[model samples]
Target: MNTKPRQTGRGGPRGTKNLPPAPDNKENIDTQILRLEQLEQKFNVEGSNTLDIVYARQENDQHHATIQAQAAELERLKEIVASFHASEGALGPNITPSGSAAAGSTQDAPKKDKARKHSAAANVDDMALDERASKGQIGAESQPSGKKGKAPKPSAPTNVDDMAIDAPDGAAAVAGTGADDEGVSDTTAALARENAELKRLLAAAQAGPVGGPAEEGPAPGSIPRPKGSAGSDFNIQDAMGLGHGRKNRKNYKSIMRSCRDLVLQARIDWERPWAEVSAATKSKAFAVAEERHPILARFFNSWATEELMKQSVKNKRNRAYKHDGLEVPEKYAYLKANAAKRNPTAPRGRQAKLGRVDVARKRAEKKKKVATSSIKTKKDAKGKGKAVAPESDEDDVEMKQYAPSEEDESDCTY
Candidate 1:
């Protein structure tokens, strides 16, 4: 048939613009899809990285917080220990912590406390024994001295009054024979007076009618009778009681002082750990001193003292070198230098004096003196040699109206 190749108009001539626009919409859709996929992937990657960073920061913060909490807890514990030690001092060593006892036992709390005290005393004795043994003080059976499987005999109570009385015998002898004879004479006089007083009292009793109970006298072996009957037995008893009371009070005061010393020692022991911790954390020697000696807290406050500041600087330097393996920065050096400047006694180089203001003042004074001298000379010259009187009388000579004397010519021969 003559209509063989009817134009289908699908594939036109090569390189023609009508060659089917290359599926532009599909290609564009594909390119847009690829860009969107790439953007999604990038967003996912960045979001994951940001989340990782956030999680890492959170972890770091938690770690730091935990460390801080631990440090705070340690400090709190130290404070608690210190408070306990202080309270223990006010309370005697026999005190027990609350809630340390249980019910239903036949022994009451006081008894339990007593038993505990005895147990502690026994332990202390054992420790002392151990110490003695370590020092080669053991006996035949390795028992401590004064403890040979038997209780020690009770010791007689020592009378301090008797000791004091005895102590004066040697002193009295050293006072010389004259003083010793005077003391004996006084004793004899006191005895004679006492005898006369007793006799007078007996006479008074006899002069009064018989029955008045014969007036009992002081017991034998009591203090030597006083010279006057006014000194009654009651006086001696009262004096003895007063002396005993004074002794008791003195003993009580001594006990209190001892307790205070023990409390101080306990406080020192309790604060040792705190001092170490403070030194480790703050790297400050003052903290250690304050922890060790609470009484010195006020003194340490003004750590600006030259010695203390120097020690602190040394501590910081050592800490920096120890922990960070680094030298002190130049900024710190400048601060230290300024501090030294503020303290006149701080060690400094002689070079610091080379450009001092004192030198400048001296130089300025010399220059001013020179300028004043020059001005004075100009003033003197401007006076026009008008027979200006000499400043000194020695320079002003009275020249008599006469020819040169013959003696002047004789002196000129030399």
Candidate 2:
């Protein structure tokens, strides 16, 4: 509150009355800080969403790979069951009592089957021994030659087991299979040898196969290749030699070229979804291809023509896309082309179909909500919508008659 006049260094002191209030920049700075923070938060949110999508895609792929493996295993089991079923006689088969093969107590089936086989072998051996003895072959072969006196006419050694029981020295006769001085001993030795042979046959029968039973694998085919060789080419087509036909045509490479050329020349709608093709169209295309190149018919049938078309069309499309020239949408790309979506349960493996998964993709889809939905511009009259349907998908491209088209094309993204 000084009353004295203020003095300036050069010109006069500026008057306080002429000076404007100091400008406040705090509000502007605060607004700018808030905007920067909001932008940063938005960027973080977008990055997190992208990461989540990537993780989901990876998880989905893993699930699909696991399912594929399980499916292969199930197919193998099916083949084994079919083979066994075809081999097993319905009834009057193995001597394990009637209905035993199909009844309970499966745990004891192997043992019972072995016993049955052993008993059958023993019975056959008895029949063979009896037949030879009745023919007097055993007695003729075992007549003692060194005895000085006229040898007693050897009894036709029929039912040697009973003779072994009745003989005065039965223990000695049964104990040794070696030929000895007396004719009776020679006959006993021969019978003992036959018994030993029968035992050997029984043991071999019980042992199952020559090298012992082979393990039933997780899947069946040829022996699986070592896992270490997995990274190298193991394409099924190459392994199965799909490119090669019966002797007399061309070499593998030349045949491959011909196949490729044939695919390019074949008439197919490359733009249309594979599932959208009519059955007649598929067969016609295959027939036409077969007419042109008779050899292709050997490698594939009408049902498999789609595979050839896909390979050729997509391969050419990819080369064009690399140079940014003949590119098509991802959906139309050979590798990327999606088949028509089926029920979510369609891809489930055997175990998954049995409801064994921790979380079913189908059930989860049912639970999930699609937040992004567009307004429905058309609705069907309840009666007409359910009463009749279009003859073909082509005929109903615009939708049902009751559900008319509208200019505002609002769609829901599922």
Clashes of each: 0, 0
What do the candidate models score in CA lDDT, each in turn?
0.40, 0.44
Task: Compose the digit string of candidate 1's lDDT tens values, residues 7-92.
Answer: 44465544565557656546745764475456557556533433233334556887999777666665665565566446434433
Number of clashes in model 2?
0
Query: What is the C-alpha lDDT profile of model 2 across 178-283, one tens digit per residue?
Result: 3211433444455457556655655554443366665654333332332222113343234334535644234433344434544433334554545665665455
- Checking candidate 1 for backbone clashes, the offending pairs are none
Mark the regions of model 2 whose C-alpha exceeds 4 Å error after superposition.
1-236, 239-267, 271-278, 292-295, 298-305, 327-414
Error of 1 at 281 (Å): 5.2
Best candidate, TM-score-wise?
Answer: 2
